[model samples]
Target: MINLFDTAKRILNPFFAKRHLLGDDNLFSINNILSKTAALAFIRAIDKGIKEKIEKLKDIDWTKDNTLPNFPKSFLDEYGLEDKPILLKKNIIEKNKLNHPDITEEEARRIIGNALYKPETILKANPNKPAYHNFISRTDDKHSDIVLLELSDEKENYEVINYHIINNPARDRKVNIHKKS
Candidate 1:
């Protein structure tokens, strides 16, 4: 006996839409590429010159890359991300250190703020480091990744124990918050 639902699915299946045959890993790799694609587009939107640099990311096969698997199609495909981003929120976000899971968007300031703001200190401290100072052991001391450890019985899966670095751009990065006259 032929089921109507099954018949309809055969007619409307996404597999036939893009000539993409499905495998367990296939969807995941495509999702990874999709993420990169969206991020690259965002970068391109910010700068005309960046358009060319980000263009290389668009060439992904989608049927190949092997990174983020089982991504929500609705989010990645339709919206590219959350409508209300956790990272972009205006409120100060801190990083936790014990469990090591919660990575926030503000983390970039660790590098940018440090590079642009603390370049002198970095250079001064690492006089023998030469011009190409990438990172030092102090990076660990400066920033942390662990958010918090977990308990077996909590309603929430993980307890987020966010910790802000003492010298975070949020706190210490204030003297030059605005343009100087």
Candidate 2:
């Protein structure tokens, strides 16, 4: 089986290496000289590889009680929380699918898991709802941001109440979360 990452690195290494020599402005000019078909094929291979990875990560059964582990120490310490059990209720999962028909239930769950575990930006102590937090992370496509609302009353057990994807996190007024300074 061909390793897409290695293949991509091999193909892209030269372009990256030439950046210092050719300078940033002329670097991307190489693409204009390369065959468009090859570029399209490379993009397709990357897309397929990403989809396969996402499919593999869908092993978690969303219907059952799943406790996500490995809370980043920084996240835990900032929120004064522990690596406790977190639940994604079936109704919320169904609601997420209903709201975002572009993605499947498994994909929704996967996004939720990603946001919970590997959030790029977390907005804690939501101004409107003190018990709720917003965990924001990039989707697999990196074209959109997935935002998850986690509710924790006693700080022992948590539940994901809502989730949605924003097309542009930079322009989205609803996404108040910012990168930690």
Scored against the true structure, residue 147 in model 1 reaches a CA lDDT of: 17
lDDT of 1 by residue, 102-181 (tens): 43335533432232212222111122322222211124434422111121132322121132233444322322321120
What is each predicted model's overall lDDT from 0 to 1? Answer: 0.29, 0.57
Q: Could you give candidate 2's per-residue lDDT for residues 1-181 as a string of tens digits?
A: 2344444444564555656433336645444433556655775765555455444446656566445443544445555677666665667767766777788666675676566655556765346566667676766443444555566656666777777666664424445433321
Backbone clashes in model 2, listed as residue pairs: none
- Model 2: CA > 4 A from native: 1-57, 124-126, 140-142, 169-171, 175-181
